[model samples]
Target: MIGQQAIRDWLFINGKIEKAVHILSSLHSPDDKVFVNRKEKDGSTSKVPCPLALKDYNSNMNFVDNFDRLKKDNQCDRKSHKWYMRLFFHFIDCCVVNSFIIYEELDTDGKKLTNKNFRREVYTGLLSRKLVDVQSPSILKKRTKSTTEISNHKPHVSKHLRLTESKHQPTQISSRRCAMCSTKKKPQRTK
Candidate 1:
């Protein structure tokens, strides 16, 4: 993680010169350097360079730290996602941060809204636009109907039911009338 700062000294490993290091200059500032330190096993220390130069730790965070803070603040740092879902969540967070920056930059009148406020406004806008729709009464009813339909239809295998007897296992044959055809009575009827 070597930053764009020009190092006057060579990189040393265990009190020996390893190589001459120089970070590529950035477009914003050529002189800025994000510096880090690594403690060697011999009790000595070495400078660790970062690729992206950032403001002082007291003033502003680096890209990595800022992203971490955003995830923490937004409560989007969930550990339950699969690999692809994790990538998607990271992309969403990046978009959110990008949107916040754009919003701040576009405000000509200089309206100062905190990150939380901006996020809340974004969420409200999404809800209003139906982009993030919640489970409404009508939708809930439809979902319940679909669930009942699914549950009424028995599966081929009932793994959860540990029936020791072979005769106890569920079978398609039943002495009931088909729900779809009320007048028809068949040995194997499905509701």
Candidate 2:
């Protein structure tokens, strides 16, 4: 079993928790520390002292719960199916939550908006900023007619051609061909 001193030492290493505990202790008043009668499992009500940290912890948890709920309601990170996209989605969710909190904090006199509504408004505002007037769709239809017309196009030269062009026999073996390339056949379409 761990001793009380060990637990205290562990708490000391956690700077944020230590700072919060110190602040709570400073603000603590005798009247503020009220004991509420809690019913026990054995059928007895006992006056239990509620710590300041419990309230702070619960409030912080509530904020996180709200942030998660808002993220779930208005998800915008499904643009790609790749695994790496999850990181981007999480980042976007964090940004939305932070922006919503900042908006709420700034507007002291305005009616408080729910997390869902706040997220929707933020998304709509972003979409509004990106909206542009398109002159014509015909501009995007232009394409190079042939491979020769493309400036960046390079013709694929076979390994045999390279060996013939070079006077010295290649000391190194040509790189192993890809499995698909060795087949020398196009994939058949299902439909």
Candidate 3:
């Protein structure tokens, strides 16, 4: 599980790195070029232009190697605790939402923006969306009342009672009524 989590983390990091590089590339002017100039004492000069910085280009390989290491470790199958899985899902959702926000902020028309302001706008938009999945009012009221009742009791609610009262009730055989005849019946013996 640790290995899997590490792999996932690396993938997410790589995605962020890609986005960062894209943002940096887009920020550059169309005609910008890195030039190596050779000048003699007589002031005659020649310039060799490079499309991209060699050092900057080489650093991406390091990120690729990190990703490969994570993949080779093969740790994703490890059984994780429920809470860890929940947190992982939450992190993934946040990343996806943020990625969308980044794209939108970068692609918007005629707007001069800083990264901090862009992130703030995205977060505000996310907050304004009615995305939370709360239960209906009556269901919430019932849950609140039940929780309060449970809390008021000195000891915790009994395991059996809790199970019975859970949102997903356990399947139970209630008196085993015959489907054909309207009568409760025991298992019949085969002759």
Could you tell me the lDDT of residue 90 within candidate 1? 77
**Model 1 scores what on Cα lDDT?**
0.53
State the lDDT at 92 in candidate 2: 88
lDDT of each: 0.53, 0.55, 0.44
Candidate 3 lDDT, tens digit per residue, 1-191?
A: 00111232121112222233322233233344466565757999977553343224544678567444533332223355788886675564455445644565578676755444544454556552322232455865665333322345343333664554444443435754334333336544334
What TM-score goes with each of the models?
0.36, 0.39, 0.22
> Lowest lDDT 10-mer window, candidate 2?
1-10
Ranking by TM-score: 2, 1, 3
Between prediction 1 and prediction 3, which has the larger TM-score? 1
Residue 81 deviation, candidate 2, in Å?
A: 5.9
Quantify how close model 2 is to the true structure by its C-alpha RMSD in Å: 16.5
Query: Local error of candidate 2 at 95, Å?
Result: 0.8
Model 2, global lDDT: 0.55
Clashing pairs in 3: 1-78, 4-75, 4-76
Candidate 1 clashes: the total is 5
lDDT of 2 at 12: 16
Clashes of 2: 0
Give the Cα-based TM-score of candidate 2 against the true structure: 0.39
What shift in Å separates residue 110 of candidate 3 from its native position after superposition?
2.8
